[model samples]
Target: MSIERDHRRAAIVALLLTALLSLPLSGSVLAAGQATPATTAPSPTPDPAAEALDRAIAYLIEQQADDGGFVGFEGVSDPGTTTDAILALKAAGIRGVATESLISSAIGYLEDAAGEYASSGPGQAAKVTLAAVAAGKDPTQFAGIDLIALATAPVATPAAGTPAALVGPGVYGDDLYDHALVLLALAAAGEPAPAEAIDALRATQAE
Candidate 1:
C-alpha cells in the first residue's frame, strides 16, 4: 500500500521510535568521583518525556488486576484493552523479569478469554493477533488458538434482505476497517491474505 520509494525510511523511523522509547524510569546519579553508597536515592530521568513515560507506565501497572489483565472503563479485565496494553508496553521497549511476567499474565488472560473475544470478529482477532506478534508470541499457536486463521476467516452471509451480490467471499468482517485490520494482522504474522480477501478489499475503494 505504500508508495514511498525509500523503504529504508521506515526502518529509520522505527529505530528512532525505539531509541525514543528506551527510557529508564530512574537512574543512579552518584556524586562526582564519589564511591557507591550503601543505598541510593531514586533519581528521576532528566528528560521530561522520559519522566512522563515513567509516570504513565506506573499508572498502567497500577491498573492491572490480580489476573494480570488491565481494566478498561468497566473496571474489569477486558481482552481488547489488555491486548492494547500489551502492544503499548512492548512499544515502550520496557524490559525486565517483572514486566515480562506481567506480559505473560496479560497473554494468559488473553488466552483465557480469546474464545469469547476473537472467536468471531475479525477486527478483534486481528487486534489480538497483532498483540501476540508484538509480544513475541506465536500468533498461530497462541492460547492454543490460531489467531491468524481466525482473523482471515470469512464472514457469515448477509441478512436475508440484503442483496446477494453484496456479500463477498473474501469478506471477513462487517466493514472495511475490519478487513484492513485483518490484512495488517496477516502481514504482521507473515501470512498471505487470501486473494479473494485482497480483491474484496480493493473492491471497497472509491475513486
Candidate 2:
C-alpha cells in the first residue's frame, strides 16, 4: 500500500510539472516579470552636438595606429603622445572598435610604452597615464607626482604641425606634425574647447 501511495504522489508531481510547462508563457510575459518597473515617456529628438560628437569619435577610431597605440607625428614613435590620443578619444566617450583584435593590439602597445618615457615634462607622462587609465588599462603601473601636475594644468591647445616641435630640436621635428595631432586629440577627448575653437568647428558644419 505504501509503494502504491508513493507511485500516486510521483504521478501527481509529474502532472503538475507538465501542466506548468504547457501553460501559455509568452516572451512578453517573461520580460514583464523580469523587468524592473519604470515609467515610460515620449522620446525626444536627437541633438546635433551629440551626433557631431559621435562622428568625431568615429573619425578617431579610424585614426588608430597600426600597432594599437596613437601616433602623434606621422613618423615619430612616441608612446606618451599615443596615450594622450587614446585618452582624448575616451574623454569624448568613444568606445568599441570595428575589430576586437585591433583594440587588443592597441591596448598591448599602451601597456608596454606607458611610464617608459618622460619627454615633455613630468606632466606629459601624467597626461599619457590618464589616457591609459581612461582606456580601461591599469593606471597604477605608471604613477608619479609629475603625472598629476600635468593633468591639472590648463589643457594645452594644439596648433597645426606642433607635434614635431614638442619633440624638441634635433629630434626630427618636421614630420611628426604634433600640433595637428594635439588638436585632434583634444577634439577626440571632447575637452570643452576655447570659444574660438568651438566657433571654427561649428562653422565647418552646414544646416
lDDT of 1 by residue, 1-207 (tens): 364745778888888668656754345534435665687789965878767777778888998899988999999999889999988787666532246767878888888998789986888999999989988889999888898888878777554543333367767666777778988998989988778877777766677
The whole-model lDDT of each prediction reads 0.79, 0.51
lDDT by residue (159-201, candidate 2, tens digit) is: 3554433333222112233223334434434443345433443
TM-score to true structure, per model:
0.66, 0.39
Q: Highest lDDT, which number?
A: 1
How many Å off is the CA of 8 in candidate 1?
A: 72
Question: Which pairs clash inside model 2?
Answer: 68-106, 73-176, 88-189, 126-147, 162-179, 163-178, 163-179, 164-178
Alpha carbon lDDT of residue 16, candidate 1?
Answer: 68
Worst 10 residues of 1 by lDDT: 157-166
